[model samples]
Target: MVSGIPWLTVLWATPTVGAALVILLPAAQRVLAKWFALAVSLAVLAITAVLAVGFDPGGEQFQFVESHRWIPSFGTGYILGVDGIALAIVVLTAVLVPLLIIAGWNDADGQTGLRGRSVQTYLALTLAVEGMVIMSLVSLDILLFYVFFEAMLIPMYFLIGGFGGANRSKAAVKFLLYNLFGGLIMLAAVVGLYVVTAGSDAFDAGTFDFRAIVAAVASGEFVVNPAVMHLLFLGFMFAFAVKAPLWPFHRWLPDAAVEATPASAVLMMAVMDKVGTFGMLRYCLQLFPDSSLYFQPLVVTLAVIGIVYGAILAIGQTDVMRLIAYTSISHFGFIILGIFVMTSQGQSGSTLYMVNHGLSTAALFLIAGFLVSRRGTRLINAYGGVQKVAPVMAGTFLVAGLATLSLPGLAPFISEFLVLIGTFTRFPVLAVFASTALVLSAIYILWMYQRMMTGPVTDGNDRIRDLLPRELVVVAPLIALLLVLGVYPKPALDVINPAVDHTLTTIDQPDPVPRLAEGPTP
Candidate 1:
């Protein structure tokens, strides 16, 4: 009833239906497959835009909700809805996918591997992954969310292994194994959560509905031993942290990023990786607020380490893709820090950062793909003075690089600033430490740009062409969004802040008072 339009169903079903259509297409009709995939993605994007217009930012409850019984005995249902947070991410997913389809239109065509099935296979898997991602974002039932969360890996696995670099198989296996292990651990927590919910007085026995669980927890009808609860919390937290691919747990990302095609990397870094951080906000804090507070120090410490370590590693990278991957680790560190700080500004900033990072990172990956396709290499020193031969590509790459560094007039700067300010209000010393990443971020981005785009034109670079019309089409929207979001972020903030406030209310936590500086002798 929130939107009275069954918007969530349409959003999820569009991609699923599209994927089925792509699979049914004639095997030889690769062109038809690409067009059909793009059309499907565009349809989803249009639906998401409509949903955004109808969304009531002031409302604190889930909107566009649809629920039907799927397993009555287990108290689970086919439920879907979106709060402000989910709404933003769902839209981001919708937007990026069409662009990804356009960017990869010819990437898999005539590729030697895969027995010439790369085009149809790539399109089908992409649509399938889109459906799974949207489902994960909107699912209101814990069981349903878990299903979508785990199922997402299947298509991504194929995308990485089937259509990537020489080492694609190895990267795909590493990615699957890491996520599979995380999912298995979370399965234990899911079962334990179900048991705990069944015992709660506030819920029907065997309920797997997230809202029901939240109600039980809030009302104190669901109780467990503190030690048991901490274990449950850790189980969920570990899965999310690994997904967030937080430090120490982040080893697989560089390999996967280096091996994946540019479009696939966008899906991994910009969309799929977001699932982890989003899970932390949705599951960890909401379901286990006490444990969240208990472990705040530990999580914050890891975040600080990720910020510094990721930036340092990025600076040392020789491969362009690997460097971009390392930068995301640093950016994600800020996101985790903001979430654990538990301030309104921090949470909102973190959410906004998710959207901003997706755009900026997509630009970087896609533009870098253009460069690699031209020079046929991913090494930083492969070619130089590229700006001389390909001015447009150089400009686009520089803008993306600047955006990654969160330049003052770019989209990410606002969110990064908010995270630091919010963190300072709660943990001044930690804020000071986290802020050091800012300088490190600048060094890595500028260093990469200088090495890759500056200096005299190298031998192979002389033949490199500027971005074609199709390539321009691929990156223009993202660049435009970065500029628009940078200047006028209020619309997004308005939608995000209320949802963050509602989340805090659910956990009965208030924003900490900012520590004010005192005047001398006042």
Candidate 2:
């Protein structure tokens, strides 16, 4: 089914082209601009679907790869490819963007105080973000990946600062500064890697091509001093940790999520933050295996702390948006824990969690947004017995919330269970500690649901309307995918396992040997 077509190029270019078209539209053609953006997103989704069908789940190497020398002098190139992991993420990005477009269509119509020009600007920026995110997923060149990675901030900054709530500017600035600081650190690491490569016998100059870098490392031609290597690892780790917003570094997330519009928050949480974990796997482990192994205990300990800390903080939140943000911090901890555990099941589970979290969190955020739009407030106390007025909306919110808590028979449950099982095989104590978050998760989600959707209808809740047709369209696919993946996750796991195995093979690491009880026979 594989075709010779430049699918990756088309996939990356479509949304950017759409953004240009929307921007070129006449000032008065706001509606046309929105529709055009939606059309472009849909097209990208279609292309992604085609990619999935043609993708070989058993393939051990990157597929649909396209490469060209962009900067021969520096050994940088324009490279794009996807393995099962990247393919899954690319599809997730495609699926969410169109739904986001639909969910935010009316909101973007300038009804919420954003004018026509502002609306157009919002849609264009959103499309641009979409394109960059996809580009990041498919890029096989570290330099190209970093370009897409850093470039994404511009449009997203505007998405928040220009189109977000009252303190949008301040939140946007904080988000920018935090990420920029991380990016600068990553830049230093990138330069250090290049220096190591150039000094090696593999080449006279360093190369930014991922394959070349991996080959050079594998041949033992590019060797970094152990001390320098550990520092480089920390440099990359700090950047991704901030981006993943792991615990102590996670301060920026709540503020940004609280201030950004719902759709923007979805993009940030669902797809963008994944880049951090994805980079940890793709770059950290692949390029610096010794450091990754050395740092495993520290990373695992932090992840466990994040799991408990995030869940406890989530239970204490009054702002619904901030609560969801905190929950993501907890969820990300699980993803990271699975990744660092290094078992095939754990790695695949982490990868699957990325997709499942994207779906589940999108539903939660968008459904919450629907409620906020109706009641004109983001406070949980402002809502009461909403089910009495809007049963469907209440039900959708419950389902999304349950998904977040990793309720059994839901998408998240499958991934979460695998992560625990995989981790328990090696680090049973850490697994047990991480499992306590399940109870805390239930308290946070159900408590929030009880406070917001149960009890008597509040004074203003009587006027609250049910989910409109457009709103349902936005959530229906997410819910359906969640259920489908929950029941039949084999398709995703099948695609993911090969890549996970390949990653472990590349790193030349095996699962930790389990300790067993001594027999009484002796």
Candidate 3:
């Protein structure tokens, strides 16, 4: 049921309005623009907290639901709602953007010859991206979700091309071309889906209403030829896979991550990437259960390949930024594997992993970005013994690194454990292969740490200063979350499990019953 408050519109529109206002601010008020943008992000965060508190996991599948006539000819509406799955990422997006704004405080200060006008543009673009992402998460109309899903690429493209390293333009174009190609394929699939609905006797007209179609699909009311369904599924999967970047399609990520500012990279990897994995759970499995089951083996194979492949490539990277980028690819592999495995634990753990990964990766990547900014380099071999001068920075880096490797007491460990166990119940050999990433992760992380932070203080490295107060503010909450969620993920899990269970029910996949080893009679 829709809430009385129209909270869904307010949740996304706040930042949209803020972005417009920030852009309208006079050029001289750049500092004011920055603070205003940050304020908007924080307000959005507060809104998410209210939604969380008001969200009753067991009450209804969608909360804060709202629908209105939009493009009546197309049978689409301005619809929005959130189940636990969507809410998890909405909250994740909200929590991360404020810190990202803080982390990127000086990233667009016209440092690389930005004519003093780039600051407001940078901040406004970030807010615009935030608003569009939230809209994509809550949207119940498929076309609306697709519009924002594709629209966000605009702000992000500017963020990548307008700021950061020399190769920024090249990376931005590559990122756009790859995703646009995928989106184009999905466009065909989306239209095909509408056409199928129009031809069906179940609807008054063709509609892009996601919930309506999901309901009809579930009741076996909306039927399409199996071959056509598979093609449609492939179209959607291709787009999401490119975004999720499962293996071979992931070449664009490393460049984009390296070229984009640290905060933007984090926003892309930690937040935007979650949406891809999210599409798989929400749309792929729900809308095309038979097709999903049929294609499970192929996807699981690619996921395992990506897991090991990303880790191996990361171990060989000489660039610190590139190394971290590769790690995200590996992490995304685990997320996809969990999703396709279809166990309740797998899906729940995947959801939690999305959130934990955002925190841990953000903490690590931002710290690394801080180091790179000071030294004016991203090469790993460029420095040694950083800990001698920047102990706090190195210490925080260590914790984030350990979390990345899924250290026993860190937040990622529990989620990783659940995913593996869940996958093992269904696909043991694939689980074993995927598990190899644990050792690979430890190697890359520890080796990088030893070279960059632990050895004797090299000549230039001794000049490296510690994290500033603002930087500490950025890292502290992420580290604290990693520790807190590591020790106790119940809060996150509680919100995620019901939603996961419902998805499993929708797909008709049951958790494998445990078969204990027989013991000798005592």
* Number of the top lDDT candidate: 3
Between candidates 1 and 3, the lDDT winner: 3
User: Can you give the TM-score per candidate against the true fold?
Assistant: 0.98, 0.97, 0.98
> Could you give candidate 1's per-residue lDDT for residues 296-349 as a string of tens digits?
999999998999999999999998989999999999999999899999989999
**CA lDDT of each prediction against the hidden true structure:** 0.90, 0.89, 0.92
Ranking by lDDT: 3, 1, 2
Q: Encode model 2's per-residue lDDT on 1-522: one tens digit a residue.
A: 556789999998999888877877877888888888888999999999999998888764798989888998888899989999898898899999999988888665553454447667888889999999899888998888888888888998988888788999999999999999999999999888878777877877888888877776766777778898898889889898998878788999999998988999999999888888888888888888889989999998899899999999999999999999999999999999999888887888999999999999999999999899888899999999999999999998999999999999889999999999889987899999999999999999999999999999999999999999999999899999988998999999989988999889888877777677898995
Query: Candidate 1: misplaced stretches above 4 Å?
Result: 1-4, 112-116, 517-522
In model 3, state the lDDT of residue 53.
92
Cα lDDT, model 2, residue 145: 89
Clashes of 3: 0
